[model samples]
Target chain A: MADVEGAVLTARSRVEVDGWQEAIRASCQPLLEAEAIEERYVERCIEMVEDEGPYVVVAPGIALAHARPEDGVKRLCLSVVTLAAPVEFGHSENDPVDLVFAFGSPDSTQHVSLLRNLARALQADLADKLRTANTVEEVESLIQGIVQDVKED
Target chain B: MTTKGNPEKRLKVMTVCGVGMGSSLILRTTAEKALKQLGLEVDLEHVDVSSARSIDADVIIGQAMHTEEFEDAAPVVVTISDFTDVEALKGKLKEALEAQGWLT
Candidate 1:
């Protein structure tokens, strides 16, 4: 499994965003700051939503934003951005997402384990804690805690 | 592909997403657990939507939005609402397998 400590680039809680696009951008900001992905990566993710609908909204209240690795990924990294107010992504079942997870991988397969761990973490109560977290540290710790728990399993 | 519960024949199950690396992989994980609980053995792979359309599989599972585009990709295309819900996936997969006579 890809280690969460290395894959996680940033974690922010209760962030204010205007809409789904803004929320995605906010989630990608840390990846950009860490030079994990280029600007085109973020644009591609937005364009994917525009072209493909809101399929990235994989679960209720959650959106996973990503594009092809060639779009512009410098390294493998993940970002978590929890919205202060939930925004609609046009998904019928998993609409009005409040938690956005953006990730960039150098290739197609390297991040599968990371996503597996992440999937397990999300299945836990991480979403509820994320919604109420106030600081980035709190969010990071929460994620780390869950990822650690999944690792033990 | 062989439909009966033959240990020699493993069904090809493909899980797809827009990019394939993210949500689809998660769906694959959930599907793996679901298939195990349902006492089914199958080969599973995750692919991007574009690539998935070109590949052949016995069953294709994906989000409702993406699976809508894969109507002709497989014998059975399953739409999953939640990628992390094993019970939901198990129920849906059981239905699809039964419909195909793959489950007895």
Candidate 2:
């Protein structure tokens, strides 16, 4: 597994958004500021949800927002944004998402290791912890714990 | 080469999403774990839903939104609600495999 020490960026606090579109935009703001991805990437992600459906709501209370690397990814990065209140993404099984993860990958390979590690972490209590976390450090530590666990394994 | 009724014939499984880079990759990892537990070998790849229609594969795994677009593209289309739930994925995959006569 790749070391995820600096790969993750967390919002300073749980953000208040009007709906899923704003939720996705807020989630990708950190990546946009870091120059890891362009504005088009964020727009494309929203467009995808509009065109298709809420398939990004991969789990209950969680939304993983991403677009094609060709859309505008400058590097490989991930961001976490927790909502002050849950927003519905129209997903029947995993609606009312409070945690959103935005991913930016320049290519196909590097993100796989991070995602694989994330997949393991998500299966645990990480989502619940993230949703209820009060501080950015708390969210950071929660993600760091996942990275540390992967290293140990 | 293996003869008839052999389980060694590797199956091609594709995991798909709208953009293919994010959730599909995660689903691929989960599917790999599920297939390993079932003692099945598979050639798994992740693709966008748009490209998935033309890609040849024995089974296609994706969210309900995307899978409905390719119902006729593959012999088996498995709709997964939660990508992180490996047990659910395993059960769905096992049922699909058994229905296709790939598992007994």
Candidate 3:
């Protein structure tokens, strides 16, 4: 594990953004700071939304911003950005996302287990809590809680 | 390419994604939530696009970009805008099941 919480805490909380473009950039900042990904990675995530029509809106109020590892991923990482006011991702069902989870992995298989745990935690229905988080510490606590839950499972 | 029209057969649902770890698992969780909400049951799995080549599923679901790769692996390939919207997923699965005579 590459310290999911540490990887995430690299980005300070940004409460406001101009739009999804800003949102994706804000979300990937920590990963970029950590050198887990490069600028092109964020651009690729944006390109994916524009080209594929916002399939990243994995759940209501939650979007996982990601692209091919070839886009610019240097390591396995998870980063996040939360908004006080949600922005539309053009998704018919799960539109207007407030929480965006940015993931970068070396390949399809490298971070499967780590991401698998995160996926289960998301499936545990933490979107509302994560979306409402006001600070990075709160987010880390939430993530730490999930990490604990992941360990227990 | 086995499209068993039998209403009694347990539907085998598979979710696919570009790499499959994060997105596909999320989709599977979303699919299970929807199916459970509608009182539907099935055997569901999640796999990456590359691994999806040989998996036999009654209906393979995924985001639009990577689903086309699985067209030959399943009788039906269901594409969706978002993988986590339970309502949309429920609606699509119902439509597919209805078309198969699995639902009235």
Computed on C-alphas against the true complex, the DockQ of each candidate is 0.72, 0.72, 0.34
**Residue range A2-27, candidate 3, lDDT tens digits:** 44433333334546887888888888
Error of 3 at A114 (Å): 2.8
- Give a tens-digit lDDT track for model 1, residues B2-103: 576665778999999887788888888888889988898789999888998788899999887788887886878899888888888899988988998988
Give candidate 2 misplaced runs (Cα > 4 Å).
A1-8, A149-153, B1-8
TM-score of each: 0.91, 0.89, 0.73
> Mind giving the per-residue lDDT tens digits that candidate 3 earns over B1-104?
12355646687889987556667877887788887886777888887777788777888998766776776777667887666567778898878777865666
Name the candidate that leads on TM-score.
1
Candidate 3 displacement at residue A68 in angstroms: 1.8
Better of 1 and 3 by lDDT: 1
Which lDDT values do the candidates have, in the order given? 0.85, 0.83, 0.74
What are the clashing pairs of model 2?
none
RMSD of 1: 2.3
Off by over 4 Å in 1: A1-5, A146-153, B5-7
TM-score (C-alpha) between model 2 and the true structure: 0.89
Candidate 3 stretches greater than 4 Å from native? A1-14, B1-12, B17-21, B32-56, B63-104
Instruction: Please write out the lDDT profile of model 1 over residues A1-153, one tens digit for every residue.
Output: 554446655788888999889999999998899899999999999998999888899888999999988999988888898888999999999888999999888887667667887787666666778888889899888766755654576
